[model samples]
Target: MALYQQVTGLEPHPKSDGDFTGLNREDGLVIGFQRVDGYPAPRWPDHRSPTASHLLQGQRGPGGSRGRLLELGAGKPDHQPHELARARVLTDPAGHPFCIVRG
Candidate 1:
């Protein structure tokens, strides 16, 4: 959650319950996080689990500006598919795929 906050600059919304944590953006985009017991890690650009979340118009990263997600603990896959030229595929510390579309 801290990683996301640093990357997007959107603070988490007030928690209704400890089980769920979420962040609400001014544009009405709300990202929610919940714990599911024994939930398997998702496969990127695949059938089982896809880009569960996507941040539209993400800036094209370069150097220190190249999305601090990696420094913040995001994972980068070894290979990216051709379909995702404009979107960068990355995983959180938990291995959930997120796409950052070039703005």
Candidate 2:
């Protein structure tokens, strides 16, 4: 939640309960997380292994900026896809992949 708060610049929803955290804004998009025991972190570009699930991204604030994401601990994958040349591919503190693209 701490990382999420920093990156998104949004507060944890008041309704968030134990083992689950969410960010709810007036935009009507609700980002939620539910804790699972021993869940394996997905391997980016490795489809044979368990891969990423929900792909939440920033669209309206600093959270959506490549610079801001890096400032908040997001990282770039070693092998970037050619398609992302004009944009960026970053990993959250938890190694989840998210993209930042221009509108």
Candidate 3:
């Protein structure tokens, strides 16, 4: 996880799990990781992969700056009506799935 933080410039949050870890940036970007034991890493652009199951949602901020408000999973809030569902999924070096959603 330290190596991941170093490479991605994301900070590891205290809220994490044995099967997963949460990463974040000061600019409101949040990412999650899941451990796939005994299974090969997922391939990019492959929806069949386990990594593709993960989704990250974000909202637009004031002055075009992104905010740290999240509205999905765990104890997060519900999505607002103005929040656009423009989602784009991408994979990290470890084949972990992440996404960017603009509203």
Best by lDDT: 2
Better of 1 and 2 by TM-score: 2
> What residue runs in model 2 are displaced by over 4 Å at the alpha carbon?
52-60
TM-score of each: 0.72, 0.75, 0.38
Screening candidate 1 with a backbone cut-off below 3 angstroms (N, C-alpha, C), the clashing residue pairs are: none
Q: Against the unseen true structure, what C-alpha lDDT does each candidate score?
A: 0.67, 0.69, 0.52
TM-score of 3: 0.38
- Looking at candidate 2, the ten consecutive residues that score lowest on lDDT are 51-60
Give the Å error, residue 84, model 2. 5.7
Full candidate order by TM-score, most accurate first: 2, 1, 3
Off by more than 4 A, model 1: 26-29, 49-57, 60-67
Clashing pairs in 2: none
* Superposition-based RMSD of candidate 1 using all C-alpha atoms, in angstroms: 3.5
Best by TM-score: 2
